[model samples]
Target: MLLSSAKLALQDAIEASPLPDDPELQRNLSEYFPAPMRQAYKKQIDNHRLRRDIIATDLANRIVNRLGLIHPYELAEEESVGLAEVASAFVAAERLFDVREIWEELDEAAMPEATRLILFDRAASAMRIQMADVLRISNGFRMPSDVVDELGRGVQKLSTGTEKLLADESLVLTTRLQREFASAGAPEKLAAKVTHLFDLDGAVGLADLAKRTEIDPRKLTNAFTILGQDLGLAWAQGTAALMSPSDVWERLLVAGLARDFQQMRLEFLQRLTRRKGMKDNPCETVNAWLDENAGAIRQFRSMITRARAHTPVAPAMLAQIASQARNVLSR
Candidate 1:
């Protein structure tokens, strides 16, 4: 028979004769009546009290699958209900269907066990998909207002219940800050100190942290600059609004000084080690080496001290090197 002829026949049969609520009967109907004819049967039963619940269950499945809801088990209880409400709203708007009646039928224990399970599973899947999409778009960051607004209008509109799933801006910023600090090789002690500064109520200031941690102000500023550059200066600056223009100059000066100090320290250590084997009196050799590099060491210390007030005149590593050299000479 032609598909249209089959549809009309199914419709007439559904209205005139009650169909058995059996899976086999449903399969036989599909095999004999054809695919297009099934929808015709659905439409015919749209008003029929006997099969309306079945039609709603099928419609619910279609709505959820269209919304990309494939995983039902992952959604929370509230999320699942919110998704169902969204599906119910869409059905009322687009299909002129009464989801309330479907819920009523299920509540009144009139809907078949099989149909109820299908509705529950589909609704759960839809909610999971909706929350997943919100997270995906936010990218663990504060979603842009325009994007949020646009999402509110898109197919899976953000209803009042689902809006809570959006990422919190401050939380996202804190997470990114921690990640950047770790990436910048900040020591765990230093990173924890900096992170604690952010956790306080006000804007994080580099100078305030320098005083609190007793770290060199220039080093603190340099660390902040590295983090800011890595995470975009605008975002980092927004988080630490007290950053000043002088911080940029301090970063450059600190970077150059650190590099020069490291190179000089390496050369001095290498020369001392080589001379230890060459000379019998280690004290003589050590004094000669110190005398040779005294001017360079003095210059480095003076430059570092001038860069930041009240900072240690020389880095602890430099002081440690001197201590080690003195111990060698004494031995």
Candidate 2:
């Protein structure tokens, strides 16, 4: 039986007023020659139970650690979702193994291509499914709606075909942010400022952050933008450092194709804007263009999807994509 199911069964057995009869238990006991032999079996059962409890506790701790690592800002807030509750949900879902697998892959300096892809795909799907419950729990804790929404978007990105890439990028960004804030003297204070500025939808102004950090607004702005750029450069360099030339070229090609598709969409919108005044009904013109280019758009999307699927991204490339996403969201 699955661990989750087994856990439930154990709970039910514990709660029963009169424990159910167990023929297997009796048979095992009968095999023993004397009272001493039966005591040996009891000792074995005690050892097994001790081992099982240790494993369960370790898994729960790992789950809490992973959740906090991924959603540091969210968890750091005064009124944030309970990490214990979120960890329980993962345990209930029997997704602790999935979380374990992801952490194993992440901790490795390098992983085999096939194994990395398989792990990413499986973990991404599991995360996507679990995020709804996490968001629900966050809401119950009265986390800011915008903060919860931001967390949702971050999780959504991490649940896509490019999950490995995004995950690596996130790791890099987190590390750099920590280092950067530490250098500013008040690591926690500066981190909260930066988190509020970018992750919290600029809920705190630049001047306010500057005042709190005792840094000039101009310097803060420069540092923020420069850090963002450095994140991209660091990711690209890291990818090159980790992968073969051909592999790197493949990644570049996939990125180029995605960018081209985005540019195509932009041009279409530009055209719509230019023609808006000439059209009698803007909605009709918009619909007509969409209808006319539907096939082409579908083809472009399909090509990008296929390319992404076939091209495996190095773990080091994750930071750049994550930085790009943050930049987009901030805009």
Candidate 3:
């Protein structure tokens, strides 16, 4: 494909080359041409040849890199000589990174099936054909099916371990711990725990928090301390508006909602699977699925509603948390 493409490109360049200024003069001389006219033709042909060589060299280097034949940086020291060398280097490179990077590259390139098409569009067809052949040979050198399966199973086990951790009552423990700190007059730790607990609940997970929070524990401690100070100031300024026993109870109630919501979602999933034969997936059967779990859903909703009804300090409390977040972020 690449060789044919190169031939076509040369043909197009030759066809587009200007004939003599006067067509009749050129026909009179038959195939013979003046020196200046011949020079012009030779210059145009040379220009096309140079361009083809540059493009071919670039395509060759990319093929070599993709196959893991050579590092891109090393191309300066060890350049491919021609199309055949590019093809040979590609085969070698595929083996070099076969375990990981090569597979990842092919996967990103949408390989095995669509790889040929993707490569053809990117480079000359000769280069694409060579790449496709190298990829096929690389497939034969892949890890054994059993080893791949074992790796897949190991991944599944790690995922299950994560899910088990999420299912733990650790949130409840942390919430109680925060309240204890609050009661003990360690508002900085209390706020830090609150921030930490919420961060843990997020998709970012605990590992990220551990890496980030430990970097400046002192800074975080100060932010929460300032937050505690601000809350005190807010309460001093508007005690009747911001402070209430019910507000504390309401936050506790809100914190517990995370656990309840997780349970409710799991229950819905279970009911959904059991009903799948009779109904479509949630995309089409969400209302019916909800209807089946209406009682449990209603109970969870009532708890949230009750919690909100008890949360007397809304905008004021949210403002405090926002202030604390800004303080921490600024630090």
Instruction: Judging by lDDT against the true structure, name the best candidate.
Output: 2
Q: Please give the ranking of all candidate structures by TM-score, highest first, separated by commas.
A: 2, 3, 1
Report the C-alpha lDDT of model 1 over 46-74, residue by residue, as the tens digit. 33454534433443444443333423222
TM-scores for all candidates: the values are 0.19, 0.23, 0.19
Give Cα distance to truth, residue 300, candidate 2, Å. Answer: 30
- For every candidate, C-alpha RMSD to the true structure in Å: 26.3, 20.8, 27.8
Least well predicted 10-residue stretch by lDDT in candidate 3: 201-210
lDDT of 2 by residue, 1-331 (tens): 3444434433332223111122212322333335666566766643453433334444434443444333322322222334433333344222312244445534452544554344344343334234323433334422223333333333332223321222244355446645654454433532333322112111122223333334433333333333323223323323332343345445444333332222222233334445544123433444455466556545544433443364576433343343343333222
RMSD of 1: 26.3
- List where candidate 1 sits over 4 angstroms from the true fold: 1-33, 36-43, 59-70, 78-83, 86-331
Report model 1's TM-score to 2 decimal places: 0.19
Cα displacement (Å) at residue 104, model 2: 2.1
Model-by-model lDDT, in order?
Answer: 0.34, 0.35, 0.32
lDDT of 2: 0.35
